[model samples]
Every structure is written in C-alpha cells, then in structure tokens.
Target: MTKAHFDDLKALVVDDNAHMRELLHALLNVLGIREVVEAADGEAGYAALAQYQPDFILTDLAMQPVDGIEFTRRVRLSPDTPNPFVPIIMVSGHTERNRVEAARDAGVTEMLAKPITTQSLFARIAEIVEHPRAFVRCDSYFGPDRRRRHGDSHSGPWLRFDDSAPDVVTI
Candidate 1:
C-alpha cells in the first residue's frame, strides 16, 4: 500500500509502558501518520478518545485501572463513548490462545503480537484500511464479525454448528 493511504490518519497509542508508547508513536510516524496521541493506560486512553477522536487505536493488553480488554469493551458498549466504531488494534507480548481470544471477544478490530516489526504493523493497518470488517451485534457480543473467511465454497452444517444467524449491522 502507498504511504498516501496513511497520510491523513490519526492514531491513539495506549500502553502503560512509556517505552512501548514511544516506540509505537515512532513507528506510526514512519508509516506516514503524523497525528498520534499517546495515553499512559486504558483509562487515559478512554479520555483521549473523546478529545482526539482518532481514526484508530493501538492499545496494549495489560494496564492498570483499565486493561485493553475493558477499554475495548467500553469503546464498543459504553453509552457515552465518543466513537464506538473506531478501529482498535491490540498489541501485546502475550500471544497465548486465551489472551488472543479475550481481545477478540472484547471487540478489538485487530491484534498484533509484541516485538512488533514495521512490516507487521503495516500489514495490520493495511488490512484495516483495505478490508474493513462489518460489525455484528448479538445478545452476547457487540463487535466486528468474528468470522474472517468469506465466499467459502465448502457448504456444510459442520462449518458452523450454530445454525442461528447473528444480527449484523454494517458500519
């Protein structure tokens, strides 16, 4: 993708570690994102969301007062949230299945493992820009559609055990 795609984007970097926040800011800059806002933790990140209204968010999984999971939940479920639809990409050193599932269930738009490289970061951003996922809301979940695959020719009830269709709302 071209740098032009990111030229006008604004991002929020939320992490308890100052070093990680700085590193993310620098990486965002290199990718042609000049307007980046940083927050010390998810609590501050939530506040910044209203003031900055960033196009997207980059948050760490672990933090005090509020972790990324809770923050993402608030962003997607809070009545007073400024921008519930804003894309959130959670970054964490922990890539365990449980942690990944938690982030996904909490409404994160994407997940990026820690020790992040420029290429990986760009790839995630590119995916967000190029193929924005439609949001789905159900009694138990309110977030992007969990299913990533589309147009699969394999038609079988085994693919999706639950025949019940989720109420989908495209954003």
Candidate 2:
C-alpha cells in the first residue's frame, strides 16, 4: 500500500449511533490519524466544525435532528468557516439511488455504505483528499484498463477486480 500523507490529518466522525461513531474513530486511529473527534449527529458535527478545523469529516446520512446532506451543504457554503475546503464523506446504509444522488448534490466528496470496512474507508478518503478532480469510475474499483482525463496528474489505487466485491467504484 502507498503511504498516505496523514501526518497532519485530523478527522471528525459523526453518527447517531455511538457504536458507529466509535467504529469510525477506531478505524481512523488505526490508519495513523492522531486527532479524531466524535459527534452524535449533524448538529453536533457542525458545532465541532466551528470549533475544530479538521482535515476531513465522515458523517452518517440518516440522523435524528439533521441529515448528512444539509450539513455538508452548510459547511461548503458557509463563509468565514474554519475548514471550507475540508473533504466531507457521507456514510449511509441506504443504497437507494435518490439518496446517493442527493448526497452528491449536497457537495459530499464521497459516499460509503454501511458495514464499512477499514480498507474501503481509507480508500475513499485517500481518493478524494489526494486527487480532488479525478473522478472514480462507478462501474468498478479495479480496472480492465483504467483511464484518466485530460490534465489529471495523480494515479489512484489498483485493486484486483473481483465480481464479488461490493463495487467500491468511484464517480
């Protein structure tokens, strides 16, 4: 695995479930991330954002008070914000097309489905934080032959294409 530039990285994990929040925190810690903050939901997540300027954020789509999409929009559009350019990742159990599309419209950098594994989480984080513009092809994570667009400079992961993998394809 290629070494990530995670030395200066700090992350905030937001979820309604305590277990989910803790799971994300633990995963990030294992990835060598030093500063990890937890929020119960979007409201708390936003509050944390105002206080701590994290390098990245991971939030759940479904929450009690506020949902993930709105939270992401607020962060991206809010002026005088601490971390306006901070990459926001949305985690959801919902695999519905509308929810995913809405998350994209709300300015989410990436989406991770439920039962998120360490590799998938880190892969999504790395893909966006490292190469902001090069879109991930949604068809598959691995390649028959991957392609890059004009002016794109970075190379992404090369996973073994398997029919069984849950299509961690980016787009």
lDDT, each prediction: 0.88, 0.74
What are the runs in model 1 whose C-alpha is more than 4 Å off? 1-5, 151-171
On residues 1-81, what C-alpha lDDT tens digit does candidate 1 reach at each position? 224666788999999999999999998898889999999888999999999989999999989989999999999999899
lDDT of 2 by residue, 114-140 (tens): 888878888999887667643333322
- Candidate 1 versus truth, CA RMSD in Å, comes to 7.2
Estimate the TM-score for candidate 2. 0.73
Q: Can you give the lDDT of residue 44 in candidate 1?
A: 96
